[model samples]
Target: MIHILYDRKPMLPERHKGKLMDNLIGNNLMQRSKKHFSMNRKLPRIPINRRFIAYVGDDFHFVWVLDFNYRYVTLQTTKNHHQLNLLFDAENRVFLDCRLVKTLDEKSRKGSIYLYEIINFEDALECPLSWTRTKSNKFLRKKPRNSYPVKLTG
Candidate 1:
């Protein structure tokens, strides 16, 4: 099951973390758990943390590392077709626009899970737990209450 948390947090003081945790965490947790059953049998043991670390590349591209049976799924989004194709060629994964990625009605408006295609990579090359990090001033900060909705493809 994948937990989803999408919101642009303006630059705030450290105290905001506690407030975020106390409030936004519970709303989506129940839904993610319920929808997870719709995906697969023999449900994988998911960690309870709400935040996921993602790597944001040039343009609006972003990818996250997911623990799926110890295998990793790379999820990303791009702003335009050109950028998306460039990313697809570079990453060699099935690419999908964020527009096509569906989310529950209750999802936040911060970002959408668009189209997704599968890509194969050698485990020897990619670290199992390595998450994408934002290089910009806004980090893909994983707060205690932060999480990303999983929109995986076959």
Candidate 2:
């Protein structure tokens, strides 16, 4: 059996699992990613969805959401120095997943930009630890998984 996660609704039917995510992205009805450069703990707004997603074609890299919301979603990445991403959505269909790439200044950290896709048919949602965002980059203060699993749900 499969299920889809959503607020105010019970588990979605199994058939709707994969198609749900595709529909959301295709219709651009779901969340959005806000990309910007952060300085002095201040987030600067820039063009959203301006960056292209890496390793998508051959490597099939994508965002596996561990948590999700209307404005932001917590997801796992497939590479090192790029563990978790905070996907911020401003306008519909325009979003950015700010991946913390490096520690730059004393107060701000550098983040890589990427296009994110929410994986459908995951598991029940649970709140994780607190995450901070400055500028356009999003990184976890705690250590994220070094490797990705074959299947990511919920």
Candidate 3:
């Protein structure tokens, strides 16, 4: 006696309607569909274009930060087999201890792209010496000197 119209046509006849609904519910089709939709959802990432210094052992390498979220970051760096341990962002004065999650190869570019999961993060008031940029466009520690002359008045 009930009518279910779909696209100007009845989806199912009255006798088959209850049976189909019961079968779909009993098979957990609705729950499966919900889970499928939720599983494909991805966290939104904030896009950024910045450079960071990744330290591995005593040596360091430069990496370009492309995008990031709360727990993950995407980077582009030279082809390196060594694991990256620490990342220092000089412009932001933040340090990120991260682990590599994935690496993607670029055919058109010279370097490889990487995805990292941040294990720990810290902020600093001063930039690290190895990553600091000087006025001469070099990555060197600036000498400690007074920028202006001090006048002594007694």
Candidate 4:
């Protein structure tokens, strides 16, 4: 003998009443939660393998251009220089006024990755010759003057 059992109603609790029907009928009306949205950047970044020069204090550091956009640039270098605020591409004759936004140290490669926020961009190709002269003068004035040590005679 075989017994067949049949139930007329679902076994869900009273609090969950009509939730199944509501989900099916109102699926389109439901709005996505805030967590579903991401904090990803809106601008598309262009990947580049070009090497560029950046001025960190008195020494010029060789940095690889990993990627860039109009607002930001990502660079990689062997030396972990914290004061990397200016990126000067002599070949392109382009100057990027930037500030260090973040830094990641790669322990495996023993190198540092830097993400800089581009504050201002100046392209020599678009600017007049006079602009370059004034800009160069401004940079020169910022450099510290070399002080020669005087010979002391006893």
Sorting all predicted structures by lDDT, with the top scorer first, yields: 3, 4, 2, 1
Candidate 2's clash total is 11
lDDT of 1 by residue, 12-96 (tens): 6556545676566776786667744445535343332223323234444344322232222223322212213212222333232
Off by over 4 Å in 4: 1-12, 15-37, 83-92, 122-154
Give lDDT tens digits, candidate 4, residues 1-154.
2333353455765565657868965775566433465747877776765677788777777778777765787888776554565445455466776677787556447367778777774452253433223224566567466666779999
Candidate 3: segments with Cα more than 4 A from true spot: 1-43, 80-82, 89-93, 105-107, 122-154
lDDT of 3 by residue, 43-128 (tens): 66767666767787788877788877646777887755345755555556466777887876563464788888776633322444
TM-score of 2: 0.19
Task: Give the poorly placed runs of model 1, Cα more than 4 Å off.
Answer: 1-38, 41-108, 123-126, 130-154
Give lDDT: candidate 2, residue 84.
33
Instruction: Give the clashing residue pairs of candidate 3, or none.
Output: none
lDDT of 2 at 103: 33
Q: Which 10-residue window in model 1 sums to the lowest lDDT?
A: 80-89
lDDT of each: 0.35, 0.37, 0.65, 0.64
Better of 1 and 3 by TM-score: 3
Q: Candidate 4 has which clashing residue pairs, if any?
A: none
For candidate 2, write residues 35-138 as lDDT tens digits.
55554413222222232333332343444444333233333443433433332332222334344444322321333222323332122123221232336535
